[model samples]
Target: MYFIGELKGSSPDLKISLYKWNSKFFVKFETPDLEQVYKISEMDVSEDEIREMVNEEFIEKIITRFKEMYQDLGELMGDY
Candidate 1:
């Protein structure tokens, strides 16, 4: 129910967390590659709300973005 940090690589690495409370879900984003963690954002929503809002097209778009970002990161890290 959360869209934590996006994965951008051959394997997706997520820097996000999800929490549930009272049948509602919350997502939290964390800083990448640090000894200490910092929150970037948070959102609360219900399962039905998510199912209604997020569809296949939206998910595909996200996957594309992650792939692009992952490739870019790999290049930067000289690991590709």
Candidate 2:
């Protein structure tokens, strides 16, 4: 994978990286203890569109999902 660049809207605590490998584009979002990744076909969307897609609302949703993931993991670990 080739490292492209990070999202401008990403916060210091949350790093978002963009990568391109073969015919697919990979977007990776990482927090201190958790991460989320998504793949997109290069033919499906342009690089510029990816930037547009990751707006404030999108970032909010990602944050919400990260919270949910942390909660779920905590609960799972508690059970263990």
Write candidate 2's Cα lDDT for 1-80 as tens digits. 99999986778889988899998888889999999998999999988888788888988899999999999999999998
Clash count of each predicted structure = 1, 0
**lDDT (CA) per prediction:** 0.43, 0.90
Model 2 misplaced stretches (Cα beyond 4 Å): none
In Å, residue 51's CA in model 2 sits off its true spot by 0.9
1-80 per-residue lDDT for model 1 (tens digits):
43433222212333434445445455333334321122322255444454444445654555566567667778988963
Q: Which consecutive 10 residues in model 2 have the weakest lDDT in total?
A: 7-16
Clashing residue pairs in candidate 2, if any? none
Q: Would you estimate the TM-scores of all the predictions?
A: 0.43, 0.94
Q: What TM-score does model 2 achieve against the real structure?
A: 0.94
Model 1 / residue 68 / CA error / Å: 1.3
Q: Which residue segments of model 1 deviate by more than 4 Å?
A: 1-18, 21-24, 27-45
Compare the candidates by TM-score and give the number of the best one: 2
Error of 1 at 3 (Å): 13
